[model samples]
Target chain A: MMADAKKIVQVLFEANNIPIPPNRAAIFEQFIKKPGSEAVIRALLANQTELMEKWKLENRIMDIAQQPVRILNATVGKPYETWFDFDQLKWKDIAAFEFTGLEDIGLTFDPKTSQLSGVPAQSGDYKLLFRYRLQEEPEDAPYHEKVIPIIINPDPKSLWKKLDSNQQDPYWKEDDVTAFEPLGDRSILVSSKRGRSHANVGSFREDDFAFKALPGGWNIVVVADGAGSAKISRKGSALACNTVVEYFLDQPAVEGMAVFDELLKQYKTDNSEIQKKINQHVYNNLGKAALHVHKKLIAFAAEVSVPVKDLNTTLIFTLFKKYETGYALLSFGVGDCPIALLNKDVSEVTLMNWIDVGEFGGGTRFITMPEIFHDQKFATRFGFKVVEDFSYLIMMSDGIYDAKFVVEANLPNIKKWKEFLADLGGKNEDGISVALSTANPDIVSQFSAWMDFWSPGNHDDRTLAIVF
Target chain B: MRRLPVYLLLDTSGSMTGEPIEAVKNGVQVMISSLRQNPQAIETAFISIISFDSTAKQLVPLTDLASFQMVDIKASGTTNLGEALHLVATSIDNEVAKTTADQKGDWKPLVFIMTDGIPTDDWQKGLEEFKKRKTAYTVACAAGSNADTNVLKQITDNVVSLDTADSQSIAKFFTWVTASIGVTSTRVEDAGKEVTGLSELPPPPAELNIVV
Candidate 1:
C-alpha cells in the first residue's frame, strides 16, 4: 500500500511538471506511514481533476474580481480622455463585454476592445456600468457588472492661471499679505500673516484672503487657511479665496439677490419653516460654490501635473446684502475657519457657521477632499441671518481663535468667544467696532501685528477678514 | 481630519538600569526636538509611551507631538512583557478615535517595542489580543545580546537586534526611530497614505543588526 501511494504521488508530480522538493518528499514518506494512507491516496487521485478545475476557476475570479476602473474627474467645457482596458481585467476567456449608462452622459464606449472615452457634457456625478462574461461558462452563467463613478467639474484653468501667475511672481514677498484694500464706503480689511513657527522655518504663509464690492452695496469676503501639511497649500489657499470672490463677483446682481430675496420671503412668517428652506437653499448654493472650487483645484492640478491633494485648503465666505427690511448675511464654511456676526453694540458675537474638528483630533475637511462629496456635513455648512442692526461681520482662520478663545483644545461657546473678543478688543466694547470702521492704512498693519500676539502653543498662519 | 498616533513600548526591567535607562530618556528628548522641526509631524503626530517592569503602566497618554514632553523612566523589577502588551491593547481600544457615519477617524497607529530582556510572564495571549487590532506598523527591537529575537519575531516581522544596550547604541536606535517617524509623517501629509511597512529604514550603525 505504501509503495502504491508513493507511485501515485510520483505520477501526479510528473503529469503536472512539478518538482518534488527533498523536504516535501520526506513529508510525503512520513504521511504514507499513517493508517488508512491507501484510502487517502485513492480519494486524492480521484478528486485531483475536480480540485484542479476548482482552483483554476477561483484564480480566474480573483484575477478579475478587483479590477477597479479608476474614477476619472474632468471639468466642464474641457476635453477629457480616459479608457477602460480589458488588459487590467485579466480575464483571458472573456467572450464578450458590454457597457451601459454612458448614453445619458453623451460618452462613447467600445465593448469590442473594452475601451471607454469621452468628454462629459455636464457637471455632476455619473455611473458607468460594465458587464462581462466568460466564454466557456454555461449559457445561463451569471454575468458580472461593475459600476464606476465619473465626476464632471466646472472649468478652472483660467481661474487657476490667474492664481498661479500671482503665486509665481518673484516680486511677491513670502510674508506679504495676499490681498488687503478697502473696497468702498464699506471698509473691508483683509490681512494674513505667517505663523511664528512658519517664520522660524522661513516657510511661506499658507493663509490667504480676498474681498470685492459687488454692485448695489453687496460685499463678498472670503478667507482660506491652507493645510500646513500640504506641499502646495499656499497656492491652494490663494486660489480658494480668489475663486470664491470671483464667483460671487461674476454672478448677475439679480440672480445673487434672488437667493437673498428667497430667504427674505420666507423670513418671519413661519420662522422654523423659513429657516429650513433658507438653510436648504443656502446649503445648495454654497455647496455648489465649494464644489466649483474643488473642481478648479483638480483641473489646475491636472494642467500643472501635480496631485490635487497638494492644493488643500479650508474655505469660509460671506455674501452680505442690505435690503429695506434689514441686512441679510449668507455665510458658508468648510473646515475650522469661523464666521461671526456682532450685534450693533458689539457686546454679543454669534458664530454664523460653527465648525469643530472631526472625530479625530487635528483633522479638518478641505474643499479639495473627495470625502467632502460623500459627507455633506463636512462638505459645507450654511448660516443665514437677517438682522435689523449689526456692528459688522468677522471671518477668521483657526489660528486666531485657537490662541484666544479655544479652551483646553476644545471649541468655546459663543459666550466665551464674546469674552475673548472683548479682551482682544480691550476694555472698550468699541475696540472691534473701531477697528472695523477705521479706514486708515495702518489698520492692516495693526491687524497683522495683532495676529502675532503671544500664544503658548498655538502658532499657525493667521487670516482675518472683516466686512463692515 | 485625522492624526497619526505613535506608541512606544519600553521594557523597564532591572536589566535596563543605569546608563541604558538614561540613554533611553535622552533618546526620547532627541526624537522630540527633531520632530518639532517638521511642520507636518507637528501638525499630525500624536504620541504615547508605555513602560513595563514587574507590572506595566502607561507613562504618557496620547498627546499631540507639539505638546509632548519626555517623562523620566525608572527601571526596576522583572520584565512583564505580557502586561505591557495587554496595556497597549487596552489603550489603543480606548484612545484611538473611530470613524462614524458623519466623520472620519484617526489614522492607524504606528507601534514600536524596545526590550533588553526576555519576558518573565506569559506574553502569547497579550500578543494575540494586540494583533487583533494590528497597527499600521509594528517594529520590535531586541536591545541586547540576552534579548530573545525568536519571541520578538512572533510579535512582528520588522525586528532589529542591538548588540549591547550601551548609551551610543541606544542613541543610534532612537535616531533611526525618529527618522522613520519623520518619513511616515511626511508621507501621510503629502500622499495621504498611512504606510504599513518600512521599505526604507535608516541603516543601523555598526552596533545594530536586522533580525530576519
Candidate 2:
C-alpha cells in the first residue's frame, strides 16, 4: 500500500466531480507537505473515504440506505457476472469504489468496469457492502456505503444423495435392473432404475417390469409403477408385472392365446361374425390376467397382514402378436402409465390404453383399488390396435412419462413422441442414448444410464420397456 | 420450470411495533436460510411477501430462493386484513402460472397468514375475492390471545394459535412453515399430488396449538 501524494489528490478531485486546476502539481505538493510518514498519509486517505460515505448517507442524496437493496442471483460452481445498475445513480460520476464480501465468496470487483465477476464456491445469501465516493461531491464529502444482496443457489444435481436401498427387508428388490432380449424379428430393451428421490433416502425402487416371448409369435410387456406413498408398493408392483407375464406363460393362458390366434385368422376373412367373437376372446384373456393380479395382490396383502392400499400401484401391459399382414397390439392399463406404438413412418402414434388421469386431478387409480373392478368402464380400459408396421412399441411407468411427456394428452402427440424417440437416441441432457440396434453391445447399460438423466422436480423410480 | 409459489401475509399493525416485529423479521430470515439448504425447496419454491398495516402492499414480488432478500418494515396503524387478502388474490392471478393443454404450469400456491389483531375492514369481502383463486393450501395463524381464532377459521380451516406474539413462539411457527414448504415441494413430485390441509403439514411446535 504505497502512498502517492499526486494519486491521492487526483482521486479526491475526481470523487468531487471537479476538474483539477492547472496548478494540480502544486496542489499535490502542498497537500502532502505536512505529512510525516507513508503510514500516516495512507491513514489520512482511508479516513477521507469513510467520512465521504457518512456524508452521503446523512444527506439522503440517494435512497439507497432507505430502500431495499437490489438482489443478484448466482449458482454454486457457476460463473456469475453482473454490472451495477442502481437507480438514480450515475456510474461515471463515482470514483474510489471499494467492495466488501467479494473475497469471502471468491469473487472480485473490477472498478474500471464496475463489474463483479467470478465463480461462486458456496450457496447462500450474501449482502455486499459497497463503499464509494461521488465525483461531484465536495472534498470533505464522505464515502457512500450501500448494501446489495447476492444469492448463490446450490446445484440440484449435487444435492442428490445416492445411498443403496436396504437389502435386509424381506420383500427387498434390487435397486436397478437392465435387460436386452431378442424376440423373433424385434429386440426388446428394458431398464428400471431407482430415481434420485428414492436414492436420496435409501428408499426401495417401487417400479417393476417383465417381458416374455409366448409360443405363438406373441410377446407380452408389462410395467408397473408403485405409488410413492404406499408402504409395500415395491412388492405390489413386482406382483403386478410378474403375475401377468406368468399368466401368459402358464398352460391355460397359453391355450387361451392359441384360441385367440385361431379367432384372429377367421376374423380377418369374415368381418362381422368373427370380429364379435375375437373381441370377446381378447377381453376374456386380458381380463383374466388383470383379475389374477388383483386377487394375488389381495392375498399377498392378507398374508403380510397389511392394508391392501399399502400395495397400491399402477399397472400397464400389452400383448402384441406379429402376423404376415401386420401387428395386433392388445393393451390394458389401470393407472397413469402409457403403452405407445409408433408407425413405421414415425408420423403417427397409437396410445394403446385408456389412461386414468386428469379426471382425478393428480391421483392415479391403481390396480389395488377393488372398487374399479365393479365399474362398467373398467372393461373399456382394454384397447386393441392393429398397425401395418411399426418403428417402436414402448411401455413406461409414470416416472418416465412425467419427465418426458408431462401429461396424458402428450402420449398420442406425434411430435412429442418423435422428440422422445430422439431423446432415447441420445438428444438428452446427458447425451446417453439407447441404440435401438441389438448390435450395440452396451445398449443395456446405456439405457440404464440414460434413466439417470436429470429432470428437476421429477425424480421417481423409472421402468421403461422398448421394442424395436 | 414449474415453481412452487409461497405467499406470506404478515400483519404489521401498531401492536407489533417492538419485539414482535423484530421477531417476525428474524423468523423470516431463518426460514429463508433453512429452505435454501433443502434440495426439493431450493429447486421449486418461489417466495413473495405481503405486509398489511392501515393498508396492504406487496413488499416483494415472487422471487426464487436464491435472489430473495428481506427488507426492514416498520409496524404502525390499524390492521387492514381485507386489503391484504385482495392483494394476495390479484398477485396470484398475475404471478402464478396456470396449467393448460399446451404447457405445464406452476404448482398451486401455498398461503400463510399471520396476524395479531382482528381486521378493521370488511374481511369477508376479501375472503370472497380470495376464494375464487385456487391454492394448494392456506394456513392462518393467530399470533396471540388477542387474535380472533374464529375469524381466522373463517379464512381457512387450517388455523393454528399461539399463546403469545413473542420471539420464541413466532420463530417456532416460522420453522414449522419452513418444514411445511419443504414437505410440499417434495410431495408434489413424490406422489404427484397437492397438499390441502394441516394433516399434510408437519406438526406444529409446543408453543402453537390447532385452532379447531
Best by DockQ: 2
lDDT, candidate 2, A1-468, per-residue tens:
444655775686689996677777566566566556455677877998789876864565475455565647788888889876643444555655689889898789886676889998887777788887766667676778888777777766788789989899887999999999986578899989988789888999999999888877779899998888899999999999999998898989888888866666665534778877877877899989999999999999999899999999889999888887778888889988888888998999888886787632356799999887899988788888666789899889888887899877777789999999899898987788888887899887888888888887788888888999
Instruction: Quote the true-contact fraction of every model.
Output: 0.02, 0.56
TM-score against truth, every candidate = 0.59, 0.87
Off by over 4 Å in 1: A1-173, A176-185, A251-267, A271-288, A346-349, A354-356, A370-380, A407-412, A426-442, B1-78, B86-112, B125-138, B154-158, B163-167, B178-212
Q: Chain A TM-score of each model, in the order shown?
A: 0.57, 0.82
Model 1 over residues B1-212: C-alpha lDDT tens digits?
46788999999999899999999998987787677656567666889999999999999999876456566689999998988899999999998887664334677899999999999999998898888885879899999899999999999999988989999999999998898887776666443456777565556567768888
The CA lDDT at B150 in model 2 is: 94
Model 2 chain A worst lDDT run, 10 consecutive residues: A86-95
Best by lDDT: 2
Q: Cα deviation in Å at residue A384, candidate 2? A: 2.2
